[model samples]
Target: MKSFLVGIVLGLFAFKCISSLYVKVLKPQSTKTGPERALLVAPGAYIKGEAYEPLGLQIRETCDFQLWVVLLLDFFDNIVNPLQLGEAVNKAIQSLKDEGFTDGSPVFLAGHSLGGTMVAMHGKNHYKDLSGVLLYAAYLTKGNKLSDYPVPVLTLSGDLDGLTRITRIMDTFQELYEDVSSNMKAKYRTPVLVMEGVNHGQFASGKMPSNVAEHDLPPDVTNVTAYQKIARYTCSFISNIASSSALSQQVLDEGFNTTFRLLEPLARVKALETNGFSHWTELAQKYIIELQNKTQISVRGIEENGQMIKFEFLFPKAEVHNSAVAITTYSLVTYPLDPFDVTLNPLSPIQIQAKMLSQERAKHVLPNGRYGAGNITCKDINQLSILEAFQNSSDVARERFSKRGRQIYLDEDQIVESSVQWQATQLRLSDGSDGLHVSSIKYKLPFDPIQESKSGLFYCALLSPFRAMEWIYVDSMRLKS
Candidate 1:
């Protein structure tokens, strides 16, 4: 009898594993059957920055407008090749309209890193009818407004992200939307979401971990566990917004009514620690009760472009503030292109004899500890010089690279000397092992080497050595501007 019970348990485990794998492979197959009610604009993985092949092809097969995922790497591929970003956006937008998905049906735009930023942009400019927006380590372009929001937006990021440092970006988004539309700004609305323990790359389930090189551990952090709970709640909020036309009113009423009606659940917070529930859901249901008790909080107008956009939150301050404990804020702004600069010349790809070279002129002990080349340029300086701006500050450089790297100059040994050429520019890399070899990096704003400044959604694309060259093609080659 014991052996039989053991066999039954093992069989069940096997069934679960097989079922999980089957669902994973067939998940994308959702597009095969008919006109989808929802559309997904997915960001490209590390390889294909803007490869819309899956979505394009999926539309041809399954007419179901159920979901759309747009790959961002290609949509914003200005880092490696600054030509394809605009084209990707245009094509994706056109694809949505062309599919005959006009009104009522919800559209979802989601991307990781650069892809996520594009989703934000798309939702801001187009997709007025979208149900929700989800971003992972994404950046927001300045001047774009997301206020008077027709749909809810969920921006997720790991607290410990070293590369993207998206915390600042989230703050900027919250501030920017405060006054863009008086009607859209939330008086008591919380826009920023902080996911504890999640690294920048863990937005999806089962994908390879971005930090796998250093740590062979499972993905779990106290904060991330908290974040996971929040994610479910946020997704549900967004899904509901997309599902209903009177979403704004309904969400507000439901949220407000629940605040007072569910006080008993909030009172059991301490008991939760002793009783040890089966899942976090039990805890979350209690938290929802806490939200239902607050009658309302009034939020005044928000400042935007030096002007105020008025709106009010009816929930009480204590309830709203408590709700925002996991979230934080930042600031963002935009400046227009200078029209007086008539000498603006578009950067044409140059044929570069790719030889890695670092700054040999180290006359004194540098603060950043390493002597690196000024921005590597093919020929003329243009907007593609953003890589230089994101370099570790001299202080950070000295600790991590200068002293540790042990070489006299920074990035001196890591340079690869080879003949590398863009369409019109020739790239001069640092020729040594210490020199950083960038696989892929995408930013929203055009780099201005001449001005010596960088801005917008900056992303680094990391891939295995085998997939390096494929990165070029997967990142679309079209230029929109």
Candidate 2:
């Protein structure tokens, strides 16, 4: 027992010596140019600043910003207490100032995961001189108040990040937005970009944890592609901040709009990748055909009048009825080119209006097995309700539904073959056209089957829920003019 104790003590001492040597030998280095803006990046736990060398180089190549990579002492010290890491970063920043980094130029702080949280904490104290804060897969600790920070913040996270829950981050962002003063909110819009299908570690092109399997990690584009996307957004945000003349109300509004416009394509592509549609052509024919067949609408043509493109489709009439209950549904699905093909003209309008002719026939059955015709009206599905449903569904299930048009049955429902009547539904584009690439189909409940339980037709309605028409596969050439 005495010998074992000595061996354990010797092992710990050796590890400490090795770690101290590594820190001294591989201290963080700065990519110094005579650029006005400076970016100080803090690395995550058990990670060295060298891991982010490629990303740093990419950012510098794209923008006129100096990059400073700050190395912390060791993994244990940084993880157990981030204050030491923060102090090391402060020292690095001070060194850069001494090396002719002028106060006239702005400084931006950025980090990934735990490093992100560290910078957020550090920025709260050093907010006066910071142009902005950029966080990738940021994990917030208890009592961390992002609302107190005065600088603009841009947080990027992946949906498949096993380490951090995106919903919680979204909640925190909302709270921060609400807690800020109206004036501050106007100046610094706290934008959170949640990249679909990206995992926690992929944000940085570094050695990932060995315990995580490659297949279990979120699907990503090539490493170069992923880093390029991140770098572009980071450079754009910092550039906007450095170039802005004032935080006046009008300037703030314009700045926010411009920022979102630049970010729209990046967000759209990320969503498309998440839904298993990586390239533009892969999403072209199948997706367009699915929408047409599901809605039972034939595309008339696409008319381009200057900057606006008008799409016209024909909506056919249909009737559905049962002994005690009947319902008629009408819908139209539209697919525009912007979200799928970002290279297209940015001047394209976000939404194109569609005109649909709707008709409904509803009937109620009597207790004596007699059909009773009743007047019924079709109403649009609530947008909030659809959003709630999407949020409630699992990520994998949602991706399958989006990519393959597969329907997800409720947990209580048995996995037996089921049939549902197809209906014509209209697709409305929301304000933000970020995720509008996917086809949107809607079905209206013509009658409340639950209310008609006394009529003995409840089981029949329940078995066959409302759905779009069965799609018939057609040659891709048929869709062309």
TM-scores vs. true structure, each candidate:
0.33, 0.46
Count of backbone collisions in candidate 1: 87
RMSD of each: 25.0, 15.7
Q: Could you say which candidate leads in lDDT? A: 2
Error of 2 at 362 (Å): 20
Residue 208 of model 1, lDDT score: 38
Candidate 2 matches the true fold with a TM-score of: 0.46
User: 1-481 in candidate 2: lDDT tens per residue?
Assistant: 9999999998887556444422211122355454467776766655665666677666766654564433334545434135355455555566666666665567777877777877777777778767788887783454655554578777766544545544345445455445544545433445555555566666655566442232123444566666666666676666666664333334334434443443333233223222322222122211222222223322222222221222122222223233222221111222334332111122112222222211121122222222223211111112222233344444543453456332322212111121122222222222121222123232233334564321111111111001110000001001111
Q: What lDDT score goes with residue 286 in model 1?
A: 20
Clashing pairs in 2: 324-365, 330-424, 331-424, 331-425, 331-426, 332-425, 332-426
